[model samples]
Target: METKFDSTADAVAAALRELIVGGELGGGERLVERDLAERFEVSRIPLREAIQQLAREGLVEVFRNRGAVVRTLTAQDVEEIYGLRVLLEGDAIFRSVKRLDEETLARAELVHRLLGEAATTQKQGELNREFHALLYGACGNARQLASIRELRAQVERYERLQNTLLADTPSFQDEHVAILQACHERNARRARALTAAHLDSARRIVLEVVERLAA
Candidate 1:
């Protein structure tokens, strides 16, 4: 059955993701289907569908009798995600920079400036992804970008630990500027190096929070 907020499973999943990412839904907390259905004004069918979506994203876990609970990510998960990011995004930016003109790099710079002015964590996250997409979309491989997007979605669980992790810090500001400058210079090797360093730095920043949570 469907309800006002449950127009589609994607809608319900997005609602649930906001709660999880914003930390309202604590890790390991059991998801009571009946309660959530009532709260979201949706029927069990769509609510279940939403939970399943989150499960695929590694934010939810389901068991035969125990039902679903928020997944508690481990330190290893952080390592694996960022490791893959280094490979995927680093290479994409390398290819992208080789192909993009200075104008495209300037477009990404515009977003980078707005990223500096973002007031909230949510806005910061949005601009950050936008900047990357604009910066790397020129990689010209739809399949590569699709995989990168999936990895990014998975990393959002860690990224949203923003109270403890660095989301829009000055370090990020400086780094984004540097990366864009490299792109402006049309230095594929330098851009790839910067991207790799950026991903590693991010892995370190988020790993601290995730490891403690794991322990």
Candidate 2:
């Protein structure tokens, strides 16, 4: 039975995003409108709208005859996405660290603490976003922040994949602490370097997962 939602399209999109990011939908799997509409207990219009939303997020690809399919990430895609992230996020963190306010740092610390206690991968991912946003939000560049958000969205599925498969890895948590310390010390150069290295580590891990999946 599907849960009732006031805003059907938004709810449906959120549910589908969870499914896709959780790997239940899998890459390259076609999204059948009739089946999905029936599953979500939503009419075709809202179901279509939900799929279109995913498409805009780069999570789904719309085709003429084939309809919507989950977007599969290639090694090249990982390289490009993480490359841009390194550039944009590195600059953002650098600027943010130099202008770091006490309030933002305190909020980030709170989020980091909550992140450590988060039991579920989904919860951790959400907190991770909040923590990074807090740290980078001090950059005072709206367009740069927006660009970083878009890039993050594009690679989020892979991040979830890494968390699910490599649950024992504490590297991300450790790196977050190091990055936060840099921010605390107001070391813009170190913060930027750590941020770039952290992203590179994630990119490499995701690339390995993609390769393993292909194999």
Q: What lDDT tens digits, residue by residue, belong to model 2 across residues 143-169?
A: 999888767876677777746523733
The segments of candidate 2 whose C-alpha lies over 4 angstroms from its true place after superposition are: 1-8, 162-169
Q: Please give each candidate's TM-score.
A: 0.86, 0.85
Which whole-number lDDT from 0 to 100 does residue 68 have in model 1?
Answer: 99
C-alpha RMSD by candidate, in order: 3.9, 4.9
40-155 in candidate 1: lDDT tens per residue? 89899999999998898777899998999988767888888888888999989998987887777777888888878877776777888898998889898898897787677666
Deviation in Å, model 1, residue 146 alpha carbon: 3.2
Question: Which candidate wins on TM-score?
Answer: 1
